[model samples]
Target: MTRSTPTKPQANPGAKPRVIHPWPLRLTHWLNAVAVVMMIGSGWQIYDASPIFGFTFPPLITIGGWLGAAIAWHLAMMWLLVVNGLIYFLWSATTGHFRKIFPLSPRAFWHDLTAALTFNLKHEPGVYNAVQKLLYFGVLCAGVVIVLSGLAIWKPVQLWFLTDALGGFVIARYVHFFAMAAIAGFLFIHLLLVAMVPKVLPPMITGGRIEP
Candidate 1:
């Protein structure tokens, strides 16, 4: 006689699936962060060499000890930024990430803005709130402008058309600077929000798990 054995049933069938940031998205994100930091630091040094504005970034914050070294570092990080950015764009497009940030409604944005200003906006993992969506979209646009303006500045002679399109080298520098400012501003707010909602930080670093 053979004894029949019963298999154990699966646990918590009703439990929500754990949501995580895809590895590709996370990888590209961190890479972009590193590249941005390097570029900003090195760019500051380069800017110090030829200040467009009266004020210059402090030597402590700038990367590279001298103008030449700063230029080298800036160019090197530019490549990383471009490559990583391209990967992110492709991944996001193919994976439909753009969808999360698009078709933004003025109504929704105003509502969210009011809620945020009043400190009543709820934080939800794995979802982009209206304010977040607007910020992401704006930053993405700024990134494109910065990259193109950078290239125009980098090889103004070879990329003369681009430089001209951006209203020449001097204008390109201003455009690039403003674009950097925008990104930096976004970074400041992003960090501030992260500080306010510390839990969001883990998901960025560790691809946090969340219940639906």
Candidate 2:
């Protein structure tokens, strides 16, 4: 039967595109995301008992019912965070990422600090500055503290040694709460900075390249 129908020309394929988020960053980001969500949910449950801001409403149920559930969720998420954070720390240390993030020179520190402040003031800040490094370091350290304090309070019977090491149950609880508050505060500032920059979120969310 007659001639074959003319076929449409196909475009030539090229090399695969590079993803923005490296495997390590993506894993850490997602694990942190899950952990933070669980932390917030359980935190609300725990807070229902005290009912700050003059609000006395329960979270999903009465204070006591949800509090135990919240603790369970919080503890589970804490394990995930601890494992993921440790992996990230080890990866960064072994690779050159740690050096890039934590510049040791005094001049570099001052330069980064100035750049960050200037950038905040509507001046051009080149990539991440010293303040950003410091913040990252602080968050990492805070995460460690949170995990230790959490263990001390959460498993006083099983981890009586840690509980005793950190003074007592009451002090451990207090430190855990403060660490949570610090992490929350950091989250607030992180969100604010992202909103202000808008450009920052795309890299983490879509694995897109961030243009300078």
Q: Over 4 Å off in model 2, which ranges?
A: 1-20, 47-65, 104-127, 210-212
Q: Please name the candidate that would achieve the greatest lDDT relative to the true structure.
A: 1
Model 1 per-residue lDDT tens digits across residues 71-178: 999999899989999999999999898888888999999999999889999987888889999999999899999999999999999999999999999999999999
lDDT of each: 0.91, 0.70
Cα-based lDDT at residue 64, candidate 1: 91
**RMSD of each candidate?**
6.4, 10.6
Candidate 2: tens digits of C-alpha lDDT, residues 1-212 = 89999998765566365555667877787889778667766766776655444664455642236667777787788788888888888887786667655665667677766755566433222245555666677777788888898888778999999999888888886777677778878888778767767766666766765232
